[model samples]
Target: MEKKIVISDEQLQFLSKYLNKKFPNLSPQVKIELMDHLICGFEVKGGDDFYQYLSNEENFIKGFINNEVKNVKKTYGKQTWRQFFSFFTSRELLPITILTLFIIFLISKSISNKNAWLIFVVSTHLIMIVSAIFGMINKKPLRKLDEVKYLGAEIWLPFLMVTLADNLGFKNWLIQNEFIFTGYWFFTFIYGVSAYIVLRRQKKIILTKYKALLN
Candidate 1:
């Protein structure tokens, strides 16, 4: 019969410190997963040469972290676009979408000056930039997975919104053109709404994942 190896609290702390020292910027979520992997790998080696094993795997772990972070960002990138388009396909969101477009139409008709409309669109983009800054600063102690997923999605989103807005605002001629300016307002409004929906969904998922962590 084989004896089961259990890691001691001291050993776990040492492992954690080692991880922190090696990867200072590791996301809490990935850190936790890596911890589990280390423990399992150590146990598989008859609980011997833990330090040697860790040292050997340092580069491999770094590569793993890089890949994981990239994959997470890529996934959220796809999800944001998917969520944006979902508004049109979703039966529940259909009414809200129609109402939103009607309101935009009303606003467009009401604003006679092209300059005013350009200002309005640029202001909306500025608001998104502010929101992105908030997301980065608002740190909460969440579960490992929640911290990873929430930060991953939230951090990536603000950059996208800010970049999109900045690029559009840069094209002074686009906003000045009669036909493009009209479509630009609708695009900005819908894009902002989609971003809001995705952020809200992320909050909901994080809250649901670890209700006790926040309390």
Candidate 2:
């Protein structure tokens, strides 16, 4: 039978501090993930002394951490896109999806084009603000859901699109052309909902994964 390695609380704290020095802006979730990985590596490498093992393999460990960071960033992007597309294609969500489209269509039709565009853009910004606030007000000791860090694309992509549209004079073009404006409005709403879904799903996963640690 393989011997089990038990990591003590003090040792865990040291690991945490070491990671902070290594990655000043590391997310709580990623910090925890890397800490677990380091402990497992220590066990497999026949280490009775964690600090000594880390010192002996300092260069290798740094390279490994760097690779893991890249892998995590890539995986996060892939998971987000997969979740966004899955939301649109799910059979169970089809009816609600249709209803949402209908509501957005009605909203676009009933309001003046310029007003509708303003509302869509403003609401998107408001959602971003609320999401940031929500992350800050979390009472958990370790806040895994840092909105700026995790949802960088979701929060800023729409704003960037709006900026690009204005710079390209698409805003005036969109408002002047009712058909195009309606389509743009629908796209904005759908994108916002998809972002919300991604945020909720991510928060759930992080909370579930770190439930014991949080408590």
Candidate 3:
């Protein structure tokens, strides 16, 4: 025999709000079907009275929202990883590479001390390589792969400037003189821009994913 289930006004309101957000145009039959399924599931899960079940249901809804928030955060974290690798392979990594080469050239030109340059270059390269690898392995990708492509383009500017400076010998120019600390400012600007872009992208992706889950 199919058992009947009862729901409270509060539970009905909560479910209605949730469903309306997901399906603003949802048909009456569809809403009824959803409510029926939910009520049946709630009854099976062990609430004997409508009020008791509604209480439990409220808690369940709260927990569900909490979990969804966490998942959204996780999704954003993955997108960040994607951005990191994309940035690394695209342009941000180039400045470091150029800087290393410039350091080697200076060392060779000045003291004929290949060892010092070798150590600096190798250590820096290894550190960067290892960090990239670790980030790739440990970082999660945005839950929705399609959203990854929409990441804002503005984040690339700082990287572009840094690369340009390094390539045009401006970075070396700054390094040779103690008063030319403007390069560091530019670098800091790049970091700040990258962080802002990543965070903004994360927020957008998370909200989109959460809204999609309602349907």
Best by TM-score: 1
> lDDT by residue for model 1 over 1-215, one digit each (tens)?
99977777888999999987876766666889889987887787765666787888888798888888777666656666787788789999878878876765665556665654555556566646644654322435543443344443533343464356557674556444545554666556666656555655665665666566567
After superposing candidate 3 on the true structure, give the runs of residues whose Cα lies further than 4 Å from its correct spot.
4-11, 14-40, 46-48, 57-59, 91-192, 199-215
Task: Score candidate 3 by TM-score against the native.
Answer: 0.36
Collision count of model 3: 1
lDDT of each: 0.64, 0.66, 0.49
> In candidate 1, which residue pairs get closer than 3 Å at backbone N, Cα or C atoms, i.e. clash?
none
Residues forming the 10-long window of minimal summed lDDT in candidate 3: 131-140
Choose 1 or 3, whichever is better by lDDT: 1
Q: Please report how far candidate 2 places residue 60 from its true position, in Å.
A: 4.6
Give candidate 2 regions above 4 Å deviation: 1-63, 133-148, 151-153
Give the per-residue lDDT of model 2 (tens digit) for 128-207.
Answer: 77656553225354443343245435645666667777899778877767667666765665565566666666666666
lDDT of candidate 3 over 1-215, digit per residue (tens) = 76755666787787777766754544344456656766777767755555565555655544544554455456655655565445447686667645644554555446533353344334434433433333222223343222333232233444455456558876556445432433343343434334454656555544555454545
TM per candidate comes to 0.66, 0.64, 0.36
lDDT of 1 at 185: 62
The TM-score obtained by model 2 is 0.64
- lDDT for model 2, on a 0 to 1 scale? 0.66
Candidate no. 1 TM-score: 0.66
